[model samples]
Target: MQKLQTLFAPSAIAVVGATDREGAVGGAIFQNLQKNFEGKVYPVNPNRDVIFDKECYQDLASAPEVELVVIVVPAKVALQVLEEAGKVNIDNVIVISAGFSEQNDSGEMLEQQLIGIADEYDINLIGPNSLGVISTHSGMNASFGPALPQTGTISFMSQSGAFVTATIDWAIQRNIGFKDIVSLGNKAVVDETDLIKEWGDDPETDVVIGYLEGIDDGREFIDAARDVVMDTPVVLIKSGQTEAGARAAASHTGTMAGSEQAYEAGLRQAGVLRADSAEQLFDYARALAGLPSLDQNTVAVVTNAGGPGVMATDVIGESKLSLATFTEETIDAFDDCLPAGANIYNPVDIIGDAPVDRFVEAIKIALSDRNVGAVLVLGAPTAVLSYADLAEEMGALAESHDKPIMGCLMGGKEADAATKILDKHGIPNYFDPARAITGLEGLARLNTIRSREYHSFEPFDDVNSDRVEQILSDAVADGRSRLGVESMGILEAYGIPTPEGEIATSPSEAKEIAEQYENSVVMKIVSPDIVHKSDMGGVDVGVKQRDVEDAYERIVTNARRYQPDATILGVQVQQQVDLSETTELIIGTKYDSQFGQLVLAGLGGIFVEIFEDTAVRVGPVTDREAATMLSELRAYPLLRGARGRPAADEQSIIEIIQRLSQLVEDFPAIMELDINPVVARPNDAVAIDLRLTIDEGKL
Candidate 1:
C-alpha cells in the first residue's frame, strides 16, 4: 500500500511516445495529462521534439528524472520504453500500450520480457494494456479517457478501459465523484487486490468499487478484501461467470456448482457486496460514500405522491430492508402536523398538492421515530411544490438527524438542482422511488458488512488425518480417480458417522454382514466404472437377512449387465436407515477452478440438482458458517421442524459439513465429494450413501 501511494502520487510524470500526430493514443494521453497534472509533465518522443506546444524530450534518458512513466507506444516499442524507464531509475510505470498478453503469442512474449524487467528493477507497473490511472486529489489524469471526474470519496477500478471512460461520463452527469480511478487491463503487475488494499489505507477513499471481469487469485482476493471491506465498503460488478463445461465431474456437487456460485459464496464470505449491473455498482457506491451507515434495516417513506410512496414501500418490504413501523408517539406527531386527507401511516403521504414545508414536516416526524432507521423522500413534480427549496429543507433535516435519508425527486431536469443540494448534505436523490429504496438498502448492507463477526476454522481433535491420507494413497495406487460406498472409510476417519457397512466379495459374505444389522440391510453393487447404482438396478434397500444372498447376487448381475467390462468390486452390505422421521439432505464439496474448494449444503436425494436449493461457501468452514450455509437453503424450514414434523438434527448435519470441509482441505487429492441423503433424524445425522472423486495427478 505504501508503494502504491508513492507510485500513484508521483511528483513528475513522463509520457513516452508522446506525439503531435492526429488520432494517436500517445497524443491523447499526453494532452489529457497536461490538462490536470499539476507536476512537471515531460513528453518523450524521438520523432518529434514538440507535443501540444509543450517541449518534448527525445527519450526517457534525455528527460529529467521522473517518478512515473506512462508508456503509450506500440507493443514492440512499449517493451523498449519500459526498459528505458527501468534504466532511468523510475520505480512506477503505466503501460497504456495494447497487444500485450491480450493479443497473440509475440505480444505475450513481450509482456513476459516487460514483467522480467519490472521485477529486476523492483518497479510498480500498472498495466501492459490499460487506459491508465487517475488521482483526482493529486490532480493527475494519466489515462486517455477524456472525462475528469468530480472530487469525492468514492474510488473506482475497472478491467475495461472503455468502462472507466463511460462511467466517468455517467458520473459527471449524475454528480457522483471519485477520488482515484484505474483501468486494470491485462493486470500483469498491479491488480484489483493491490488497489483495494491501497484504498483501504487511504483516508481520502470512503468506498471502493470496481468493474471486475475476473479475479487474479481468488483466494488471496477474498482474504485481502475481507480485511478492508469492514472499514471501506467494497462494491463490484463482476461481468463474466464460469461453469464446469465438458469436464468429467463424478459427484453431484461438481455438476451443480460452478465458478459463478463460487464467486457468489467467495464474495459474500469476503464481506463484499455484489452488484448485478453498472447502475447498482454506483448506486451502492454513492450511497456508501455519502450516506451515514444505517443503524437498522427498517425505512420510513415520506412522500407527496401516494403511488410512488407505495412503490418505495413495496421495494422496502421485498428487500432485506423492512418498512419502518413508526412508534405510537411518532404516529400521533404526524397526525398533528400533517393536513387532512393524508395517509398518516408509515408511508406518510401528505397528499399530492402538499408543498415543501408539509413534506419537510412529515419527514421530520418520520426521522423522529426510534423505529425508523432511515427515510425515503419521494416527491413527484407538482406546481405547488418547489424541488429546490424542498431539497434545501431536507438537507437541513439530514444534517440535524443521525438517520440516513435518500430522495426520489422524480422529474427530468426539474429535480436536478435539488439533487445537488441533497448530495451536499450526504443525501442521495433518485428519480425512481424503487431506486431510492435500493440506495437506503446499500446503507443497510454496509452496516451488515461492518458488523459481521468472521469465524475461523474450528479445530477438531477426533479426526484422524493419517487414516484419510492412507485411503487417498490406496486410490492413487489402484489408478482409481473415483470411489463409491467403498470410500466411506474417509468419512469415518474424519469422525463423520456413516451407516455400519462392509464390502462383501461373495453372497455368503454379504449375508453374514446383513445378519449383524437387527432391522434390515441395503445391498449396493460396488464398481469403479458404475456411479448411479440404482439406475442399473444394482441397489436393493430393506433386504431381509434371509434374502441378503439373493439380493447380493441380483445386484452383482445388474452391475455386470449395465457395464460388462466394469470391475465388480463386490457389494456393500450396509445397515438400512429408517427414513420415516428423517430428512434426506446433501452435504458436498466441489473443487472450483478459480476460488478453490467450495462446500455446499441443501435438499439432498436424487432431486438435488433439479431443486437447486443449495448454499455454497469456500472450504475450511467453521461451525457458524456451516450453520449459516444450512440456513441459506430454502429447505431450511424443513430441517428446523417445519409442517408438523420433528425437527432434524441440524447441529449434527452442521458437524458433518465442517468435518467434510476439513477432510477436503486436508487432502487436495479429493477433488469432488457428495454425501447424498445424509439421513437427518431428530437426534443424529448419518451418511447413507456417498460418491467421492479424486484427482489422480494430485495424489
Candidate 2:
C-alpha cells in the first residue's frame, strides 16, 4: 500500500524521452502532466535541450532529484533507462514503454531483466508497457489520455492502456467521477492483486473497480480480494476466460471446469462482484460508490406513465430484487394524495397529467412503506409535469431514506436537464427504466456478496495422508498418466467410502472375489489405458459367482480386442450394490492453470455431458461451500427427496466432497480425477468407479 501510494502520489516525476515532437507519446504524457499535476515534472531527452519550455536532461543520472520515473522510450532504451534508474537509486518507476512479455520472446526476456533491475534497486515498478498513473488528489494526469475525471470515490484501473484512455473519456460523458486511474500494461510486477489491495483499504476509495485481463496469482488474488470485500466492494471485468483451459479432458470435472469456471469460482469465493460488460462495470461501481446498500432487495416503482412503470417492474422481476408489495397503509396514503385516476399499487401510476408534487408524493409514500426495500421513480415528460422539479424532489427524497433510490428520468431535453440535479444528491438517473432497475440490482448484488458468510477450510484430520501419498507416488513411478478402478485405495485413503474391490490377476481369483459377495458382483477390466471400460465392453455387471470366470475372460478378450497393444493389467472384481435404492452422481476434480484444483459435483453417469448440470469451486472447499455446491446442482432436488422419495445421504456426499477437496489440495499432482456413478443412498454414499490422472512432473 505504501508502495502504491508512492506510485500514485509521487512528489517529483521525470518523463524519460520527453520531447516537443508532435504526436509523440512522450510529449503527450508531458502535456497531460502539465494540465493539472501539482508536483514538479522533469523532461528527459538527449536530442533536445528544452521541451515544452522546461529544460530536458539526457538521462536519469543527469536529471535533478525525482521520486518517480516514467519511461516512454523504445524497448531496449527503456531497459537502459531502468538500469540507470536503479544505479541512481530511484525506487519508483512506471514504464510506459511497450514491447514487453505481450510481444515476442526477446521482449519477454527484456521484461524479466527490468524485474531483475527493480529487484536489485528495491524499486516499486508498475509496468513495462503501461499507460502511466493518475491521482485526483495530487491533481496529476500523468497518463497520455483525455481530460482528468472529476473528483469522486470510484477509482478505476485497467490492463489495457487504450481501455483506460477510452473509459476515462466515456466516463466523463456518462458523468462518472474517478479519484484515481491506472493502466497496467504488461503488468510485469504490479498486477490486479496489488491494485485491489491498495485501493480496497484506502479511505478515499469508496469502491474499487478494475478491468483485468488476467490474474497473475490465483491464491494471492483470492486472499487479497477477500480481505477488502468485507469493508469495501470490489467490482472487476475479467475479460479473458473465453475457451481458456478448454482441453480434451479425461474426466467430466476436467472437461467442464474450464478456466472460466475456475475464475468464476475463485471470484465468487473471494466475494468479488464480476461485471460481464462495460456498462455493468460502471453500473455496479456507481451504485456501490454513491447509494446505500440495498438490504431488503424488494423495490417499489413510482411513475407517471404506466408503460415505463411496467418496464421497471419487469426488470425488478428478473433481477435478484423482487417487485415490492406495498403495505395497505402506504397504498392508502398514495390514494389520498394522488389523482382519482391514479392506480395506487406497487408500481403506483400517478397518471400522465400528474404534477411534480404528485410524483414526489407518490415516491415519498412508497419510501415510507416497511415492505418497500428500495424505490425506482420513472417519469415520462408530460405537459403538466416538470422533470427538473421532480429531480430536485428525488434528490431530497434520496437523502431522507436510508434505502437506495434509482430514477428513470425518461426523456431527451427535459430529462437531460434534470439529470444534473439528481447527480448532486447521488441519485443515479437513467434514460431507460430497465437501466435504472439494473443499477438497483447491482446494489442488491453487492449487499448479497457482503452479507454472505465466508468460511475457512479446516483440514480433516481423519484423512490418511501417508496412504494417499504412497498411492500417488506408485502411480507416478509406474509412468501411468491415468489410474483406473485399480487405484480405488486413493479414495479409501481419503476416507471416502468405496465398494469392496481388489485387483484379480486370474480367472480363479475373480471367482474367489465374487463368491465372497452375497449375490452377484461387478467385474471391470483393470487397465490404465482403457478410460471408459463400458464403451470398450470391458465391464460386466451382475456377474454371478458361477459365471465370474467366463465374464472375466469375455471382458479381458473385449479389452484386448479393442486395444490389442494396450497393457493387460488383469481385472477388478467389485461388490455390486442395488442401483435401484441409490442415485448415481459424478464428483471430480481438475487442476486449472489459473486457480489450481477445481472440485466439481453434479449429475453422474454417461449422461453427464447431456445434462451439463454441475457446481464448481476452487479447493479446498469448506463444509458450507460443499453443501452449497450440491444445492446449486439441478439434481439437488432429487438428492433432497423431490418426488416422495427418501432423501439421499447429502451430508455424506458433502463429507466426500470435502475429503476430495483436501485430497486435491494436499497433492496438486493429482491433475484430474473422476468418481462417476457414486451411489447416494438414504444412509450412506458409496463410490462405484474411479478414474484419476496425475502429473508426473508435478509429483
Candidate 3:
C-alpha cells in the first residue's frame, strides 16, 4: 500500500481545468484548495493568465514538478491530460471530471483509456467522477468541498463524490475529524477494498469508515476487509441492501450487488463492524475507538431513576448483554455508602435525591465488583453538590481501576457539563442511558466473538476428491450441475453423515430394506429430477410392516404423477428416527464472480427464509467458528431447548458444518449442498435430506 496521502497531496499540484468563471466546478475546486491547502498550487487553463494567485499553465507540460494533478476538464480532454501527465511522470492524479463511466458506455470507454494511461506509467488514480481525495494531516484538500473537521479519528471512503462532500459537511458540523477521505467514483481501477486495505495500515487513520454503493468483487472485498479487521476497526454503511438500491448501485459503480442475506453473512464472517445508517456508522466508530476490550458482557448500571435503568436493561438484553448481579461483598460495600432503602442489585437505584458523594460511592462499588466488565453511571443533577465534581471523581476512578466507564446524566445543562467532563477524561459517555448501553452491547458482542475465536478447530482431510470429480464430470456431461440424493449420500459417508437409508431399484428390495431397518420407516421415490422430495409428495413417513407394501406403491405413483417426464430411479427406505428437535441447517457454495466458490451456512427449512438466520466463514471454517456461529444465531435459544425438551447436541451440528466447509474448500466442483431437516435427538443429529450442485467448468 503506497502511502495514500500522495494520491491527494503534492509539493506542487496542478488543477487542469482551473478557471476564473464563477460557480464552475474547476473554479470552486481551485478556490477550496487555495483556501485550505498549504502546498504549491498550479492552475492549468489554456486561456487564463492566472487564478487563485497562482500562474495558470497551458497544459501538464507547463506545470513545473507537478507531483499531483486534479483534472476537472471535459472527459475528452481529461484523457489527453492523463496521457500527458503520464508522460511527464506525474504519478498521482485526481479526476473531478464527471463525463467518465457515470454517464454511459462512451464515458466508460474514456475512463478505461485514462486507466490504461496510468497503468502504463504505474501511476495511482482516484476517480473519473469524484469530489477528489483529502488528507487533513498533510493539509491536502483536492476536493471541491467545504472545510472538514480536524478533531476525531475517522476515514470515509465512498463511491459517490456527492456523498463524500455531504458527509464531510456533516462531520464538520458535529466536530468529527477525518484522517483521509476518498471519493472512488466509478471504481474503474481503485476499489473500496483497495482503500480499506491501505487505510487500515495508514498511521494517521484510527477507525476506517465507508459508504459503499456496492462491492465490485464481493470475494476480494471480504478477504481484504477481513485482513484489515484484524488490525483496525471498520464500519461500513452499505447502501445497496434493497432491490431498488441494488439496481442503483449497479448503475452507479458497475457492480452486481449480491443478495442482502449473503452480503450480511459475509460481513459477519469477516467480523467487520456493521451499521445500518451513516449516523450509526459515525457513533459506533466514535464509541468503539475509545473503548477497551471488555473481558465479559456483564455490565452494572447505577441510575437515579428506575425508568432509565429498565430501559438500559431492555437494550442490553436485546443486544445479548447481561446485567450483572452484584455479589454479597459488592452489595455490602454499596450499603455502607448509601441509604437503607436504596436498591443494591445489578441495576442499583441510587435515587434522584442522592448527592455527589452517594453517586460516586455507587459507581465505585459497581466498578470494583469482580463480575463487572463495565459500569454505566446515570446521574441527575443535584442542587446540593456539583455534577461536574462527581463526574471528575467517576472519571478518576475509571482511570485508576482499569475498567471502562460510561455515563448518562439526566439534567439538561448540568448533564452536558458532566458529559463533557467525562469526555475530557477520555471516558466514553452518552447523554442517554439506552444509547450508552447500546455502546456497551457493542463492546460485549465483540468480546464474545473474540472469546469464541480463541479455541480453534483442526482441519479434517477425509474428503474423496476423485469421487467428487467423477460425479461432477458425469453431471456436466448430461447438462446437469446438481447431484441427486444417492450421489450426495456417497459423499456423506466420508465423514458427512446421512440418514441410514439404502437405494432400491425394485419394490421387493425396498420392502426388504424397510423390514430390515425398523417397523417404522420412510419410503421416498428417488430421482435426480426431484431434488425436493416433500414438494412432489414422493416421501411416505412412518412406514410399518404392513404399510411398507402400500407406502412403496404410493411413493412410486406420486413420483410418476408429480414428475411425468422423469424416470423412477428407485425408492430409498430408511428407519424413522424419533426427532425430538426439528431444526434445519444448510451448507452450500455459491460461484461468486470474483471470489470463486464461497461456502455458506445458515438455519434451513421454509422458515429459514423468514428468519434469515445465517452466518458465513470462508470455505474451511474451523469447528470452533462453526459452533460459535450456531450459538450466535438469533434463534439459538430454540436449539438450546427453549421449552422442557432436551437440547440438541450442539457440538454435533458444529462438526457437520465444519466437515461440509472442509469439503467445499477441498472440492471446487461441488457448487452447492443442502442438508435440510437435520433431526436432532438430544444426543445425536442426522441429515435426513441432502442435495448437491456441481460445476464442471470449475473442475
Kindly list the per-residue Cα lDDT of model 3 for residues 1-699, writing each as its tens digit: 245556745777889999888889898888877766777888999988888667888888977887899999888988888889989988788888888778999888888888888788777788888888888866777888777557455778888777887888886654567878888887766778878888878766677888877778776787677667666778777776766544321110012213554567566666677788776677677666665667877889988788888888888787767888788999888778778778888789987788878888888888888899888887656577587888899878867877778777777777767767776665656667767776666666565444434334477677676776676677688777655666654456447667777888877787788778745897777776675577778887787877777778788888888879875678888878675456566554454444444555567654554565666555556776677678877767777888776677888887887777667667776655666656655777677776666667777
Q: Rank the candidates by lDDT, best first.
A: 1, 2, 3
Pairs with backbone N, CA or C atoms under 3 Å apart (clashes), candidate 3: 152-177
After TM-score superposition, what is the CA distance of residue 594 in candidate 3 from its true location, in Å? 6.1
My TM-score estimates for the predictions, one after another, are 0.96, 0.97, 0.83
Poorly placed runs, candidate 2 (over 4 Å): none
| lDDT per model vs. reference | 0.87, 0.86, 0.73
Each prediction's RMSD over C-alphas, in Å, is 1.9, 1.6, 5.1
- Give, for candidate 1, the lowest lDDT window spanning 10 residues: 240-249
Better of 2 and 3 by TM-score: 2
Name the runs in model 1 displaced over 4 angstroms.
242-248, 564-567
Residue 95's C-alpha lDDT in candidate 1? 91
lDDT of 1 by residue, 10-126 (tens): 899999988888988888888888887788899998888678888889988999999999998888898888888878888889999899889899888888998888888888898
Q: What lDDT does candidate 1 reach at residue 131? A: 93
C-alpha positional error of residue 171 in candidate 3 after TM-score superposition, expressed in Å: 2.8
